[model samples]
Target: MNQLPFFITIPLPDWLTERLAVPMHLHDDEARMRFVIELSRENIVCGTGGPFAAAVFRAADGMLVAAGVNSVLRLENAVLHAEVMALMFAQARLGSHTLRTGGGIHELVTSCEPCAMCLGATLWSGVARLVCGATREDAERAGFDEGPVFAASYAYLEQRSIAVVRGVLRAEAAAVLDHYRESGGVAYNG
Candidate 1:
């Protein structure tokens, strides 16, 4: 018989939680972009497998519900991508499996395009929108082995009523990945 891997909880430090906490609002694209960028930087500083970060925000008010950085090393869970971690944290805070709240959708913002696992999670995450700073090509260019994400995959998200916004702050997001490479960060594909 084959054995499957399981996940264990990885608690976030109090300092990190406090540092990432932000009020919910609307029309704060710049702030949200900066938040994700900082998350990526923090991830790199922590020496994670990938310098990526993600956040879940209230769509109506822009409240940051949860933020997470890549924790494959910290948690020893290869599947715990930043987007997944953020969603997990958000769900825990909301005490619900979904991020939707009273007809308002949640928004997911990530420093880079989500890999296959995270992308699939977005579909069932109850997030109405997704914002990405860097592209999969950009990550690949930086020597990161991103999952297979074809144009049709994005189209499918749109078909499922999820709004996809790419390149919200492309250059800035790409710079984070570049910094990771320059710092000799590992790009763990698995």
Candidate 2:
């Protein structure tokens, strides 16, 4: 379990599929679009429907920067969950936790604003965290249930995101993200 370096895993919730479907992600455009497109393969193929688009301009203007996927997606559980996990693992491997907090104005490194699902994926993705706001403040913005979110989930007969963490503390991620950014760390945006 500890020796696995080729795989990264992040947890997912029952609603990730739907959440990912929404257009106009408020943060990094390229990363959000790639995540949504990859997760919506079935919907895209049918052509009957899908939220696919070349660009989703939600924040005045933005551009796609990075893209990637170094893991396999069985979709046995849910594509969104698998993708998030793999991405997270990749970030940690690249050492994205150098940006620290509490240094007289604590450089925020300007992390992208994560939408609800992105927030969930970002936090529980097994990557480090960044401090966006206060504990309760951020939680209110997440708009999801309480978390120290896990990698496995059960969603009736449909599908669900997987859990990837053991004893993940919610704020722990924020702290880590903070370091990742200020220390010149980077994320895949995919």
Best by TM-score: 1
Per-residue lDDT of 87-123 in model 2, one digit per residue for the tens?
Answer: 4433443444321211111111011222244445444
Worst 10 residues of 2 by lDDT: 101-110
What Cα-based lDDT does every candidate model obtain? 0.83, 0.29
What are the RMSD figures for all models against the true structure? Answer: 2.8, 16.7
In the range 1-190, model 1's lDDT, one tens digit per residue, is 7587585568764556778665545357667878888878876775654678888888777878888888887777788888998999998888888877534678999999998889999988988899999999889988878778899999999998899999888899999899888877777775
Candidate that would win on lDDT: 1
Off by over 4 Å in 2: 1-86, 89-93, 97-119, 124-190
Please give each candidate's TM-score. Answer: 0.89, 0.23
Q: Give the TM-score of candidate 2.
A: 0.23
lDDT of 1: 0.83
In model 1, the Cα lDDT at residue 120 comes to 95
- Clash totals for all models, in order? 3, 20
